[model samples]
Target chain A: MTLVDEIKKRSVHVDAAIDELLPVVRPEELYKASRYLVDSGGKRLRPAVLILAAEATGSELKSVLPAAVAVELVHNFTLIHDDIMDKDELRRGKPAVHMIWGEAGAILAGDTLYSKAFEILSKVENEPARILKCMDVLSKTCTEICEGQWLDMDFEKREKVSKAEYIEMVEKKTSVLYAAAAKIGALLGGASDEIAEALSEYGRFIGIGFQMYDDVLDMVTPEEVLGKVRGSDLMEGKHTLIVIDAFEKGVKLDIFGKGEATQEETDEAVRILTECGSIDYVKDLAISYINEGKAKLDALCDCPEKELLLQIADYMISRNY
Target chain B: MTLVDEIKKRSVHVDAAIDELLPVVRPEELYKASRYLVDSGGKRLRPAVLILAAEATGSELKSVLPAAVAVELVHNFTLIHDDIMDKDELRRGKPAVHMIWGEAGAILAGDTLYSKAFEILSKVENEPARILKCMDVLSKTCTEICEGQWLDMDFEKREKVSKAEYIEMVEKKTSVLYAAAAKIGALLGGASDEIAEALSEYGRFIGIGFQMYDDVLDMVTPEEVLGKVRGSDLMEGKHTLIVIDAFEKGVKLDIFGKGEATQEETDEAVRILTECGSIDYVKDLAISYINEGKAKLDALCDCPEKELLLQIADYMISRNY
Candidate 1:
């Protein structure tokens, strides 16, 4: 099967598991709000990473499906809260949870998903020691994720952010969950500690690359294809790596942080970034990170699932929008 | 010792454990914001319950201290989030976390505390199976707390809420954490399942009474003693059992849900509710629940710690604030 087909084959199980594990029960409105953003369309990249990591370790997908679902729930929970924090109104082409349910409702919805993630993970059929280890990994990752978001918001208020600070923020905010996914999948599949640690590194590297490439896409992708305004992050003054690199190169883009730009102005800014090599700089860095992530798979035996995992890492930067 | 002194004796250790287990690290401001309300002087009742249950089950204080700290953190986490959702400006006689750190900061802070709770709980030295069980209990309790909060916000929009519905909300919102605390302490302390379950029931009953009496104290206590506006719940139109009973008896409360009421108006409403026996009815009901909770302690052998647990139940309703 193609990479997308392999991912979908596993993700369909994740979708079915979500319904069975997290049903819309009492206080129907709350459950509905909690399920709102979760059910909306998004590529199930995180779950796919988890399932592939487990399969690469010679485990069946069914054995680690709940852990995959738990990781996905954690991802959605962060999105719901992050949208409220960033005041983003749309997610996955739908109104953010806070927009539909109001902030209080959205807060509760996110909180519910947060707890349910743990609740579901604890029920996974595994040795208690392994399950406890996964719980530890997931919880610590969540704490790091919170720290990352704090750094992200903190960076936005300041006039300058070093590349090191930006990468640290990205690692914490976006990458740790992926690390947790791979590590958790490996642990549940009864991989050795060394293999689990390597899988976690694989996830961490690729997750960073994925986020960096996302910044590149935000600058270059068209409005219709991106599903939101192109270059919106630049207007919002977000300190993505591309912006930091361009600023270092002394590239003058008048529309940066202006909150709005005409199409021509946006085009001009993109052209300036391209000429400065800042855009390509980020693209090259993202590729290097993805390559580093794929290198971690050397610990795994030769298997079709390992090849699929390598392909997923490439897909992280290769997918346009 | 008096019940106050007894609880303080145990709570002191919990206070120390909090400092050790949840220290201010990198992202100093975020950790500071998370620690703000936690270090504030609320009576450490939940931790007291956990430690006391552990002691009653022949466990040493040092062994279960982290679990006690974990429960305390979860309580503070809920308070931080609930303050934002309720728009209550003050908590523990100071500004809420949101007031100091902004809503986004408060949200992240609460989320940090939440993951830290699970992270800390998972590290307690114990059998992995028992620790995993506690994780399940704690996570499920958290989900129930969210449901309870949702029900509370849902009730505010409606004109009437039945006693059953109010009890259910209270059980989920206010009591489940207490239940988890007692159960976790017992499990970690090596108690039998039957004994652990009884202690959980003990916590559940007293917690319900604690909240019910809290409503009564809101009416009868002076502002200086209560440390918040007396009858604020009334003005805010909270559907406490006292209000539900008063409404059932055709006692028209003019100041109810008025958002503000003069002292005279508050006093008049208090007198009307008193005369109709709604206040006394709730007071008696709270006492009965506490009694039921104390009765659950019969499962334990007679010991000083068990005696204290029973006294703690009585103190739930008897304390002025």
Candidate 2:
């Protein structure tokens, strides 16, 4: 089967598991609000990564399904809170949780998801020691994510941010969860620590690549395909790698951080970034990271699941949105 | 030592553990924000309960220090988020975390504490299976706390809340952490399930009493001692047990939900509630709960730690503020 088809098979299981694991019960509105963003679908990429990693390490789908769901819940919890922090009103083409339920409701909903992730994860049927290790990894990843977000917000208020700072922020904000997912999958599948470490490295590199390419997508992808306004990072004054690289090259774009730009102005800015090679620089950097991530998987034995993992890494940079 | 002195001894250890386990690291500002309220002095009652329970179960203070710190972090985490949701300006006689760092900062700070709680709890020196159980209890307790907060907020929007519903809210919002603390202490101390179960019950009952007494204190304690405005709960129209009972007895509170009240108006309302026996009714109920809590400790051997546990239960209802 193609990688997409394989992921779909697993995604269906994850959706079912989420429903069974987290039902709307008492205080129904809070539960509904917590489920709101999770139900509004994305690619379910994080859960796919987790399940694929576990499968590659010889674990069956059923054994790791709860872990997959836990990772996905953590991802959605971060998104709900991030959207509120960023004041973004739309998520997955629907109104954000805060938009519908209000900020207090959104905060509580995110918190519920946060706690439930741990609750479900601790119940995953595994050796107690291995499960404890995974819990450590997941919790540490969460703390790092919060730090990454804090830095991201802090960067917005500054005049300039270093490339190193931008990378650290991305690594914490986006990549660590992916790293945790792969590492956890390997550990739960009973892989040796060495192999688990490699899988974690693989996830870390590709996650960074995925986020870097996302910056490129914002500049180049059509708004309709992108599902949000194009060039939003520039409009919002985000210190993404692309903008940082452009700034380092002494490229001047008047619309940078202007909060809003005309279509023609956005086009002009994109044109300048393209001519200056900032966009290509980020794209090539993303590709290199994906390759590095793929190289780490050489530790695993030759298997179809490993091949699928490689394809997923390539897809990270190759996808349009 | 007096009960106060005994608790003070454990509180000091918890404070030092807090400093060591959650030091100011990179992203100094965020760590500072996370540590702000935690450092601000409160009674440290939850951590004391945890250490005392563990001691009663034949555990040393050093062995369960991390778990004790973990529970304290959870308590402070709830306070930080609850203040933001309730929009309370002050906590523990200082500005709330949200007031100091803004909503986004406060949210991130609380999230950090939450993930750190799990992270620290997982590292506690114990058999993996036992630690995992503690993790389950803590995570489930957190989810219940969210449900409790949601119910508390929901009750504010309605005109009348049943006494049972009010009890449920108080149980979730205030007492579950206490229960978790005691239960975790027992588990880590190698207590049998039966004993741990009893300690959990002990915590649950006293936590309810503690909250009910808190409402009474708000009405009767001097502002200087209470550390906030007197009768603030009445002004804010919180549906505490006292209010629900008074409403049931057909006692009208003109100042209820008024958001502010003159000194004379507040005095008149307190006088009316006291004259109608609602205040006395809640006080008696609180004492009964405390007594019930203390009775649960009868399963323990006649030890000083057990005596201290009994004393702590009495302290739950006896303290003026």
Per-model B-chain TM-score: 0.98, 0.99
Candidate 1 segments whose C-alpha is farther than 4 A from its true place: none
- DockQ per model, Cα: 0.96, 0.93
lDDT tens digits, residues A1-321, model 1?
A: 799999889999999999999999999999999888889967889999888888888788998888998999999999999999999988866789999899999899999999999999998999999999999999999999999999999988988999999999999999999899999989988899999999999999999999999999999999778877889988889988988998988877798889899999999989998899999999999999999999999999999989998999999999988
lDDT of 1 by residue, B1-321 (tens): 798998888888888888899999999999999999998898998988898898888888888888888998999999999999999998867899999999999999999999999999998988999999999999999999999999999999999999999999999999998899999989988999999999999999999999999999999999888778889999999999999999999889999889999999999999998999999999999999999999999999999999888888888988998
Report the TM-score measured on chain A for model 2.
0.99
lDDT of 2 at A170: 97
Q: For residues B17-77, what per-residue lDDT tens digits would candidate 2 score against the true structure?
A: 9999999998999999999999989889999889988998989999999999999999999
The segments of candidate 2 whose C-alpha lies over 4 angstroms from its true place after superposition are none
lDDT of each: 0.93, 0.94
